[model samples]
Target chain A: MLTKRIIPCLDIHERRVTKGVRFKNNIDLGDPVEMATRYYEEGCDELVFYDITASSERRPIDLEMVREVARAIRIPFAVGGGITSLDDMSAVLLAGAEKVSINTPAVLNPELIEEGARRFGAQCIVLGMDPVRSDNPACPSGYEITIRGFREYTGIDALEWARRAESMGAGEIVVNSVDADGTRAGFELNITRLIAENTGIPVVASGGAGNPRHLAEVFIKAGADAAIVAGMIHTGEYSIAQIKNELHQAGIPVRRHW
Target chain B: MTAIIDYGAGNLTSVKLALQTLGVDALITSDPDRIMAAERIIFPGVGAAGAAMESLRKLGLQEILHTVTSRGTPFLGICLGTQIIFQHSAEDGGVDCLGLLQGQVIRFAPADRRDKVPQMGWNAVSFVREHPVLKGIADGTEFYFVHSYYPVPDDDAAIIGQTGYAGVDFAAVTGRENIAATQFHPEKSGRAGLQLLENFLRWKP
Candidate 1:
């Protein structure tokens, strides 16, 4: 059986690990390499490092930081944010990161996804989207895709975009709910389920993870293959061991070796 | 010295880094001479079968691989490298592979809606028989896997480990004599993965 993944996302701002509520007013948490190593040692299935400010600031991802993190951890990790071209993807993969995620640039060009999948296998390409709930009649799923850190709306339906990205060769889709991001209320089950069921690719439920029970709910109810945790584990209140132990007790299959 | 083959397929840095963590500084190379001269060879790749086969031919590695395996130099394949070792692959409109092993690679046709293509993430491996590379690793230990096509060897003796996914029980580990291959990326599988590589380093067969 394939175990459900528990990934700890490290949102990097100026090479430091930062956390915020709904991507606003983030506080520095320390070195990304240190945090990534800690999470890997604690038995997190995988790791994701997003350069949160790279797209808005219009700069490439910090490759030095990527290289340092790649050296610090033995598990697979994905690097995203400000990955605009194939060269950017190549650099990140060569730096030892397994996958490169494209969000804003992918939405704008769309062909970048195909080219990346063609050059480097689709397994190394991940599509990260920030979707917010909307009541617009145009979006059949009632969720619209947002870009540039959720400050702008594309009016494209989240489910439609996910299907298109999968056809265009995205290996996995990370549905990071903008409305539920960092809220700790719970995962936006409706939207996550909508995308997970509609697409054939692996769906990683991101944003709004509060506890192990919340993760179990997303995995069992929403059909999520993986879930991302930031605030729940980064605050020092809950460790990865506790989270996985709780998931184990709840009967959700997760890797138990630390 | 171990040579990690780089045939312009996909990421080979992580494989080298994994070996580095085990205190073995493996070299990543595309040169046939270096690969032929190495004490061990790790053929690691992530790509389509057609493109990988083309690159392998372009770099003239097919014959080198054949000669190395025949010499019993202890060779290992990972991911795409595993699929390409078979006789043929169904990917990219039916690609004829290296035929190093008597098997054909086929894609998963899952009747279950939840079973996605390119089955990614960790899955447990059930050993059918013992091999030196998997000596210390316990049976039913999980390893990281990310692929759409899997190899089906013609001879069951070649299969050392098996895994079930997408309504198919496929070969997760297969080999004969000195040649062993894994459909999973042991380099990216953390502790258990590193253990497989460490065992490969010390493997005599």
Candidate 2:
């Protein structure tokens, strides 16, 4: 059976895990490697590490932090943010990341997605879509996709962009909701479902996970292959073990810990 | 020493780092001499079939890899590296491959009931046959995967492990003689993934 994934995301800046409300008011969490290893032990299916400061600083991925996390954990890790070129993707993959997540670079140069996918294989390439709902009545249900941590709007429809990404060879799409982020209300299931339904690639729903039931609802209702929980896990509100147990009881097939 | 073949494709760092974590001395190089001289070779790749094959030809590594594997030297192909072992790829409008294995790589059919391409994330696998590559690996172990195309072995007996996606059972791990390849990234698969790598290291054949 193809099981649903329960992923824990770590937003890293200067090698430390951090999170905030709406991508602002950043708060330091703890060492990324420690948190990653803990998540792995607690039965998280996989981990996503976004070098949130890399793109803003106009630099390469933090290989040091990547190496530390890779060395400590045994789970698959996806590294994102500031991955602009094939060289950047190669550097991070060599540094211990299983997959490279590209956002602004991929959109800026659509060929980069094709080239990267061709060079490394689509499976190694992941496209990150940070979407914010638009107020314009014409595009009510549609949202504006943001890049570089919500600094710039691509004016591209989220669902449309996700389909384009799949056509361009993105193996997976990380549908992150800017509106529901940090609110802990729940995941933006409508947005996630829209993307998942429109494409064939696995969809990982990010942002607004308040509890285990929230994760379950996202998988069961929205039909996401995985639900990414950051704030809830980082704040120690819910442990991954408990969440997996609850999800299992709720009929979601998650990887069980030995 | 283990030499990881680098053809300017995807990252070889994580594979190298994983080898280092296991206290194994490894090197990432495109040099044919070094690659051929290494005790074992890891054909690690993460890119498209056409470009990867092109880079291999550009670096003159195709023959070297053939020589090493032909001599019965241990060879492990990861992801695209595993796919290129076939005769050709349908990606990029058909590309010639190393022809190490007989078959053609094709894109996965979209979900019958409207599923997505590029099946990503952690998925489970069932071992097909007993082999050193999967030694100590139990059934129902979930390994991470990210790809749209999968290998169809010319010799069905070569397949050592299998995983299903969208109702299709694809080859997860295929072993023949000294050549062993995995569509999944064992380095990124966590504990079970690491254990699989360890088994590869200890494989005597």
Candidate 3:
């Protein structure tokens, strides 16, 4: 049986781990390498490090930080934010990360998804999408794709983009809800379910996880293959072991050993 | 010292790092002498079969790999390394592989959207028989996997373990004599993965 994954995401800013509520009211954390090592040791299935400010700053992800994290942790991790081209993708992968995610650059040049997949194999390419709820009929799923850290609306239907990206060779899709992110309410089940049920690839539900139940809801209700936690864990409100034990009791199969 | 063959593609750093964490000395190299002279050789990579094969040929590693296995140096293959060791691969529109083992690699044709193509995530491996490298790992212990194609060895005797996914029971671990290959990435599989690597380090076979 394939166990559902519990991944801890580290939103990086100036090489420090930071968490903001839906991209606002930023709270500085600690070093990424240290945080990543802690999560890995705690039995998190994977880790995601997003350079939150890199895309807006028009700079590539911090490769030195990536190298540090790679050397420190043995579990699989994905590095995203400000990955604009194939060279960037190669540098990140060669620097030791298992997967390289593209959000803004992917929307700017959809071919980047295809090219990255062609060059590095589909399993190495991850598509990180930030979608917010919208009533516009253009988005059949009522969720529109947002870019540049949720500052711009592309009017592209989230579900449709998922299907297109899959066709273009995206290995996995991280459906992070902009509306639900940092809310501590719960996952936006509507879009996560919509995309997970429709797409043939693995869907990682992100944003708005307040408790263990929220993670369970996304896994059972939304059909999410994995879920990302940042604020929930970073704030020390919960540990990865605590979360995984809760998931295990909830009957969700999660990796529990070191 | 263990040699992790570096033909330019695939996740080599993590493998080396994993070994180092196990307190084992491993080197990522393409030099034939170093790989052939090492106590063990790990042929690990991830990419298209055609391109991987091209890199191996360009670096003159094909013969070295064959020699390593034949000389009983205990060779282990991971993911792409496992796929290319087979006789042929359906990837890259029918690529001829290293042919170190008798098998054919085929892509997973999932019936619906529920079963993804790449089959990324952790899945359990059921032991079909005991092998040194996988010793002590319980049956149904899940390991991380990220690949679209899996190898079907010509003889069932080569299969040491099996995993079911996409409505198919495939050979997740295959071994015969000094060579063993896994469809999953042990280096990225956390504890169980490290255990497998540890077993490999101590494996006299």
Q: Pick the candidate with the highest lDDT.
A: 1
Give the per-residue lDDT of model 3 (tens digit) for A1-258: 578999899999998988888788888899899988888888888999999888888887799988888878778999999899999999999888999999988998999999999888888899999999998789988999999989999999999999999999999999999999999899999899999998888999999998999999999998999999888899999999999899999999876556
Candidate 1 lDDT over B36-134, as tens digits, reads 899999998888899999999999989999999899998899999999999999999999999889999999999998998889998889999988888
On TM-score, the candidate that comes out on top is: 1
- Docking class of predicted structure 2: acceptable
- Which portions of model 2 miss their true places by more than 4 Å? A51-61, A81-94, A100-125, A138-142, A146-156, A164-171
Better of 1 and 3 by DockQ: 1
Model 1 ranges off by over 4 Å: none
Task: State which candidate, 1 or 2, has the greater TM-score.
Answer: 1
Question: What fraction of the reference structure's interface contacts does model 1 contain?
Answer: 0.67
Model 2 scores a TM of 0.87
Native contacts recovered, each model: 0.67, 0.65, 0.68
What candidate 2 keeps of the native contacts, as a fraction, is: 0.65
Segments of candidate 3 deviating more than 4 angstroms: none
* Global local distance difference test of model 2: 0.83
Interface RMSD of each: 1.1, 2.5, 1.6
Write down the DockQ of candidate 3. 0.66
Q: Rank the candidates by DockQ, best first.
A: 1, 3, 2
The sequence of per-residue lDDT tens digits that candidate 1 reaches over residues A1-258 is 888999999999998999999788899898999999999988898999999989888898899998888888888999999999999999999998999989989999999999999888788899999999898788999999999999899999999999999999999999999999999988999899998999999999999999888999999999999999999999998999998889889998887754
Better of 2 and 3 by DockQ: 3
Return the candidate ranking by lDDT, descending.
Answer: 1, 3, 2
Q: Rank the candidates by TM-score, best first.
A: 1, 3, 2
